[model samples]
Target chain A: MRLLLVEDELEMAAALGAALGRYDMILDHAPTLDHAMAALANHVHDGIILDRQLPDGDGLSLIPRVRALKSGIPVIVLTARGAVDERVRGLDMGADDYLAKPFAVEELLARIRALMRRSPDIAPITARIGNLVFDFDGRQASVNGRILDLPRRELLVLEALARRQGRTVQRSTLEESVYGYDDEIQSNSLDAHVSRLRRKLSETGAGVEIHSIRGVGYLLRPSL
Target chain B: MRLLLVEDELEMAAALGAALGRYDMILDHAPTLDHAMAALANHVHDGIILDRQLPDGDGLSLIPRVRALKSGIPVIVLTARGAVDERVRGLDMGADDYLAKPFAVEELLARIRALMRRSPDIAPITARIGNLVFDFDGRQASVNGRILDLPRRELLVLEALARRQGRTVQRSTLEESVYGYDDEIQSNSLDAHVSRLRRKLSETGAGVEIHSIRGVGYLLRPSL
Candidate 1:
């Protein structure tokens, strides 16, 4: 998952970015409303963590623009403004959720997940293909009840492919899922990840295979 | 599309970044081999543009690591090393294409597109759904043989939905296709774009409808 964090504090942004990265969530940091606007113009995000106070203007003011650009995007206002009116005002301004300063990272993570669960495009929490079972919520994959420990990138690639099991997942689609703008890519990066993933799945008796569709993408299906 | 550019010169990186942005290709700049490696570890890219000289070491040396990370990712070495032996060495080092420094930006763009065409994950150049015809290569859509003008974002969303016409495209998948890591997303942005696209298509009499699958995503299918 990718998120836009509009926080002015560099430390906070860094902390959040690192914390979110553990869950394989990529973050695009916008230290100001202007920066945030530029980002919004260029990219689409699953959620936004907005700070009420920013260098250019109040983050709350940006909410309307955000709404104009993306009608139902979840925006959680994170700010030092903790009073009842402030919280209520933030909500009234269209912030879906609000949290005060010095919030627990765990709480933020839970809130993000909660927002995702309520998202209109939420996928099935769990999916099965052949003997392979995937827990989308937990970001875990297993074969016949044996958990398959895979690297973060490999897991992302697997998640994307497994979601569309029988269907071909385009290479571009996989690349978007596995890499963020911060990462550098070569044409073969996705191929390399898939090759590595295929070998691992086979060795683990996944009962599934990732098949390449030349000049197309890849299909994950029962290995019969 | 996303690419990694390994160049030590700030001016060169900035110039390339701006030039590539025009084509909607995101460029992740790495000033050194170490930075490039970090990026490689984190992201999967469609291609790489490597400069032979860098602060940390020769960019050619990074080719082996790139191969290890993503076996067949197309790599184009752009450098001042225009000697016959240097060009030959770059290709030997697994650079798919080599260009000397001071080459035309248009030429670089051409090479990138050419490499994409030959990539295993290349999608069809065009597709048809109902009366709507899409030229994936030219990035244009039409109905009744008349081009349907669309904003870049709308076109991207349309391309993704049209590519999987009659099928449910996960919101995450669509998000990946429309937004890059640099964009800030609110949960509703995709909906807004889809909604706008729907309105435009209806107004244009495209004879196709984008259906929301509720908790899944959107599907593009022929209108009744």
Candidate 2:
């Protein structure tokens, strides 16, 4: 899961980022409300962890801005104020959950997961197309109940395609999903992965087809 | 799935809403940027279908606000400004996908689904606690792969608790999940559901246990 954390303190942001990373979450740190807003404009996240007291403005104010875009994204407000009224006020202002200062990372992770589970728009954990099933969390794909022993890169390619089954995923989007922001890519690396994935799907007798959209990217469609 | 649609045109919103609803999506309409922002601050949405020409301002202005909150939430900008440069600019400014006016509702639905599937933070579709498995999409639970026949309300209660797995889910959150926003819940309705669910879990030899925290909410943890 990707998260945008609006916290001013450098040490806290680093610490929180490290902790959240262990749980397989990518966190982008925003030191101020303006920075947070800038980050939000560029990327998408599953959740936001906001610090009530930021260098630029009160984090509570950012909540309304977030609500304006997608009210369903969970916002966990972090504050040193442990007063019951403050907590109540935060909730009243639309924070999904809260955390007092010096909170345990484990508790924070638990709360984040709880908020995510309750999020109505969260896509299903697994996706099934034709006779093929993909367990995204496990990074495994199965056809007709038989697991396909796919290599890591092939699985990532398959994930990018399967996630948007029956639709064309742009070439850049697939590259971003498969390779990290800093990862180097050869011209034909993505094509190689897609070709191998295509062959594997056919060899397994999986009732799914991966079609390359000429110069665009690739699409996964159920076999006719 | 839920979506926030920011469009000033009433007829188009209604037509699009009806078409998207057939695919099991709930569309919340916002006539202006103010309304869209207000809606975003309150409810959650899987995606945002934005119109570049709004009564209040350019819908492009709202993209950053949404990105601020949940960067992962897909934004598909819809407008009559079909100029090639306009589309590229919208995407450059953080819109995930763009569609021009006079588009087919079928195409819109397909685009929306593709965006939802591409979302990275969509929580896992299925969750497991010990030998008990809960499929959020199917709204069913199984023990040792055996389907547990649970009533609607009971299943909802179980879902609220199981989503958190070992953590305690607050009472208010659980109520909102099980009942509608306008549901006039009785004092003991939740309690009744929990009682029945507990009995059913024990009777079915389910591996998970639901523990109620006094004055708080319920939690589902593996049976010790």
Which candidate should be chosen as best, given lDDT against the real structure? 1
Q: What is the lDDT of residue A102 in candidate 1?
A: 83
Candidate 1, residue B76: Cα displacement in angstroms equals 50
- Fnat (0 to 1) per candidate: 0.00, 0.00
What shift in Å separates residue A153 of candidate 1 from its native position after superposition? 1.2
TM-score of each predicted structure versus truth: 0.48, 0.44
lDDT of 1 by residue, A110-169 (tens): 998777645534344445566677766567787766778998888989988876655566
Candidate 1 chain A: worst-modelled 10 consecutive residues by lDDT: A117-126
Give one digit per residue, the lDDT tens place, for model 2 in A1-224. 56788887899888987786555556788888898887777666679998888777789999999999877789998867568888898999999999998899999988887776445354443556666877543446777657788876787788777766655577887776565433458788888888888898998888898866554456687777
Interface RMSD of each: 20.1, 17.8
